[model samples]
Target: MTVHNYKLTVTWSGNRGTGTSGYRDYERSHVISADGKPSIPGSSDPAFRGDATRWNPEELLLASASACHKLWYLHLCADAGIVVTAYEDHAQGTMNGDRFERIVLRPRVTIAAGDRALAMRLHHQAHAQCYIAKSVNFPIDCEPSIE
Candidate 1:
């Protein structure tokens, strides 16, 4: 097996003039950047006094899982001779207390040419093979609609 290493820098941009002198003094904002990649504006959830316009960790986590599964599913579909025309996912994650309990991936797939049953089955295979799904402790469920 081969192991891969990844690195990124997160610079806190939440320092208000007071600089954490009080609980509500600072903002919950930051910048996430990596070499050759565009920086991502990040902030805590709105409930935690974060900017609603910025990306939050919880949302990013869901996106990561959804993206990983989409990539893997496409690859598997190609190898299996299932032709997929388009795909989009509206994935959601549920948090229990301080941790995530589960995530559901709702993928709408458009198939130009392929066996619908085989295409649906590939979702299960894709979930099983997704690295993010394997890494996370929570359960990831896929509900795919094939067209």
Candidate 2:
């Protein structure tokens, strides 16, 4: 078996002079960074008093799943001689209170040339091999369309 380790730093930057003095005293803002990579501004969901402009944890989770599946799908397509010209996913995640209920990944793919049926089937393989999707407890659904 092979093992891969990842590390990153998350620093809170929401102290408004007085530290966590009260529930709404501090901003729900922070920075996520790793070596040789650009920092990502992070915050809680806007409903939880987070900055609407920054990337929230919920959104990041959804993005991770989408990106992981996309990478896997692209690799599978390449190996199968499927020429993908464009790919986009409009993914959505539903949260019940504090827990995520499910995530729906709607991927629209444009292929220059390939077997349409095989292209669609690759989504299943991609989802099965997605590390993020496998790690998450909630269900991840893939709704793929080939063009």
Q: TM-score for model 2?
A: 0.98
- Leading candidate by lDDT: 2
User: Compared with the true structure, what per-residue lDDT tens digits does model 2 show for residues 42-81?
Assistant: 9999999999999999999999999999999999999999
TM-score of each: 0.97, 0.98
Worst 10 residues of 2 by lDDT: 129-138
In terms of lDDT, model 2 sits at: 0.98
Tell me which residue pairs clash in candidate 2: none
Where does candidate 1 stray beyond 4 Å? none
Best by TM-score: 2
